[model samples]
Target: MVDLSQYLPILLFLGVALVLSSAFVFLPMIAARFTGAHKPTAEKLTEYECGFPAFEDSRSQFDVRFYLVAILFIIFDLEAAFLYPWAVSVFKLGWLAWGSMMVFIAELALGLVYAWKKGALEWE
Candidate 1:
């Protein structure tokens, strides 16, 4: 028989994690039931954190500008994320890496100018 002792710790760890997670999730539910706070009313069911119920259908179309802004934000955010690592390693990587990073920045600037001229930055 294959020695199963080596797997005992992993199995025990998973079993404990399962029990703890179950208690954490269900304990609040059980406490609420006994604390007279389990009541669910129509208004509570319909409530929103924004203090206003949703007016439009859930599947209504979003504005094109919303997508444009999101894409631009993600692009620039990724550029910043990459820039930090390149900055840290540029000396070790020599002049080629520095030149490539400069080109990347130039391309980002060109994209920004294009978006600005095309009125992608405008709202309404």
Candidate 2:
């Protein structure tokens, strides 16, 4: 018999989480109904973004510069994500990890400089 007693705490935690999540999601809805605050108004339902109606086509083509910015953001964001875990354990990892991290940073720095030189950072 596989002794599943060791997994009892994990199962209990998951069960509690499920109950709390369900309560949080349903309680608000039930309270709103009972409190008479669930009335729907046309103004409340309208889009309030930019405080004006959207005049442009929703599917309009975006500029390449925006895409470039997004790609750069993702690249640097992933670098930060990788750096955090590596930073935490680099001391135990020794010189090879340190050297590799430095090389990775240098490559990213070079790419950033190249983008700067090419005016890819400019939004206008």
Candidate 3:
């Protein structure tokens, strides 16, 4: 047979949370329904960008080089993030971690060199 005591608190907590949230929503909905507020207009519903009039054909294109640089920045930034946790446990990981990180650094260095050779880092 399942123990009812173990689940009692959890059930109570869930019940109370449900009741509290329901009360919160019920009060706001009741108030709003009775307010009889003015009907919304186009100015209220239309999308506004800092009070500028909406433009047609919002589709826009960006430079490919901009995307390439953004992707490369994210990749290298994530690599640095991994280094932090590994560094914290460096003593426990010892030489194996050191060698692994060395390999990783070498790979990144090679990538940097490749980007340099490909003119990916150049502005012009």
* Model 2 C-alpha lDDT versus the unseen true structure: 0.96
Q: Candidate 3: misplaced stretches above 4 Å?
A: 1-40, 45-57
TM-score for all predictions?
0.63, 0.60, 0.57
Q: For model 2, how does the per-residue alpha-carbon lDDT over 55-114 read when each residue is reduced to its tens digit? A: 898899999999999999999999999999999999999999999999999999999999
Segments in model 2 whose C-alpha atoms lie over 4 Å from true places: 1-51
C-alpha RMSD of each candidate structure in angstroms:
5.4, 5.5, 6.9
Residue-wise lDDT of candidate 1 within 2-114, one digit each (tens)?
99999999999999999999999999999999999999999879857878878888899999999999999999999999999999999999999999999999999999999
Give the Å error, residue 102, model 1: 0.8
Ten consecutive residues with minimal summed lDDT in candidate 1?
Answer: 44-53
Which ten-residue region of model 2 has the weakest summed lDDT?
45-54
After superposition, which runs of candidate 1 have C-alpha atoms over 4 Å from their true positions? 1-44
Write the number of the candidate with greater TM-score, choosing between 1 and 3. 1
Local distance difference test, per candidate? 0.97, 0.96, 0.85
Q: Candidate 1 at residue 30, lDDT? A: 100
How would you order the candidates by lDDT, starting with the best?
Answer: 1, 2, 3
